[model samples]
Target: MAETIQLVFYIILFNFLLLVVTDVSAGGKMTQPKCHRNSDCPRNLCWPPLVAICDLHKCFCRPQHVNLVVRD
Candidate 1:
């Protein structure tokens, strides 16, 4: 009974480690965006003025900017 418990614990630990390593590897390959301002964004990707976050040489508008809307 004790051996069975030990085996189960090791299996869980191994799976947890595997998941962590996979996540880290995948994150290294993700692509982000780049823009100094809304105007710098191309027509197809332009939204509006907002803070930007840089990741993996890409820039994306901050989450708070999602709530903003342009009125013309």
Candidate 2:
């Protein structure tokens, strides 16, 4: 009886830990939106806004200096 209770407690603890790990990993990874051109993304007017340009059919952003480039 005590052994059964301990087993159930361990199972619950394992599930809770798995849930927390899954949530944490998911929060760290983000999926970028698909795009055909740079115009598909929103323009950032604020200086040094962290993010984003449409490249290779996807919107990609990395930590770096982002300069707004306008082509006629």
Weakest 10 consecutive residues of candidate 1 by summed lDDT: 43-52
TM-score of 1: 0.38
Q: What TM-score would each prediction reach against the true structure?
A: 0.38, 0.39
Model 2 — which ten-residue stretch has the worst lDDT?
63-72
Estimate, for each residue in 1-72, the C-alpha lDDT of model 1 and write its tens digit.
999999999999997875554334334322234645444433433223333344334544433345343221
lDDT scores of the candidates, listed in order: 0.46, 0.52
| Best of the candidates, TM-score | 2
> TM-score for model 2?
0.39
Which regions of candidate 1 are displaced past 4 Å?
28-72
